[model samples]
Target: MRGELTAKGRATRQRIIEGAAAVLRERGAALATLDDIMARTGTSKGQLFHYFPAGKDELLVAVAQFEADQVLEDQQPYLGCLDSWEAWQQWRDVVIERYEAQGDECPLGSLFFQIGRSTPGTRAIVIELLRQWQESLAAGVRALQGAGLVPADVDADIRAAALLAAIQGGVSILLSTGRSTHLRAALDQGIADLRGTSHAAV
Candidate 1:
């Protein structure tokens, strides 16, 4: 009996969570409501409250996680297989295209900002996103090293972290100014640094 009840509850909760994310995306977090989720998911008020007893705040956390998952998801394939120069370039283009298309409407960033990323839950999500992103990038750098494309002593973690930081800075500026110059520069420099085969290395 308990097992069956738990499964049903989990399903209901996931439904509400997804519904809330859609609402937040379509209407923005500031305007999302319980009814909006109910309408989207066909769930009732009772169910929403059952899943997110704290109401919109709890649901927003779930949405934040969803968005964070998407940040990594958007860069799959190439991100997971940065084993070649071609793959790294493809990953870089994917990252640029994703952000460029989004322009200023960063739903994921909006969700975190609305909920206060400094909060423990949101902060953990942010940290987890960075950790996974950096890990993938670092793996790519290590792959390059193994390919004889970079010095074997290259510190993958530092390079990846620096590259990720530059990307974030570029994105933030792009979000503010609606320009891709910084994004382009960051990617070009990051890739150049990784390539290290350039005469600039001397």
Candidate 2:
């Protein structure tokens, strides 16, 4: 559907999605209505349907994608460059800060729940988001290896997968308990273990 949009149409559609994302975050996915989104985006019903023919569900999926992208975007330069211990620490801090600020309200998670995670579009979005996130983590591990911070024999992919899992676990706990304690421990220990690998090899 997006593939067929003109530049202006794309921009308008994106505007609607972003506005809808904000509304979802503020009102929760289950409670938000198309009228709320239309008002927020200054769009009419016709305009909204023109972009998202499937109505609220379709818009929610688009908002979900936006939130998913934001999860990575919030990590910034630190996530992109983990060549040094300093960079890794920075990334850790940013990750902690982002989640803590967000508290227990996960817009992406809520959107998926409302849309049904089994839905093909929602499932693909989640899978792609995790794939990209894990790939970035793996690249960071490789960066550390290239810089001689981690031993060459260490499996970057496995290390990255573990770290990603730990982060997700911590996030799950946070969403359940509204505490960052587990998240902090997970990140601190994950990085510490990675650092330990270098010493272990020595």
**What is every candidate's alpha-carbon RMSD to the true fold?**
2.5, 0.9
Residue pairs with backbone atoms closer than 3 Å in model 1 (clashes): none
**At residue 21, what lDDT does model 2 achieve?**
90
lDDT of 2 by residue, 1-202 (tens): 7799999999999999999998989999999998898899999999999999998888888888899999999998888888999999999999999999989988888999999989999999999999999999999999999999899999989988899999999998999999999999999999999999988878
Error of 2 at 101 (Å): 0.6
TM-score of 1: 0.91
Per-prediction TM-score, please? Answer: 0.91, 0.98
- Model 2's number of clashes is 0
lDDT of each: 0.86, 0.92
Best by TM-score: 2
Tens digit of per-residue lDDT, candidate 1, span 117-179: 699989999999999999999999998878877777778999999999999999999999999
**Residue 136 C-alpha lDDT in model 2:** 94
True lDDT of residue 73, candidate 2: 94
| Candidate 2 CA-lDDT value | 0.92
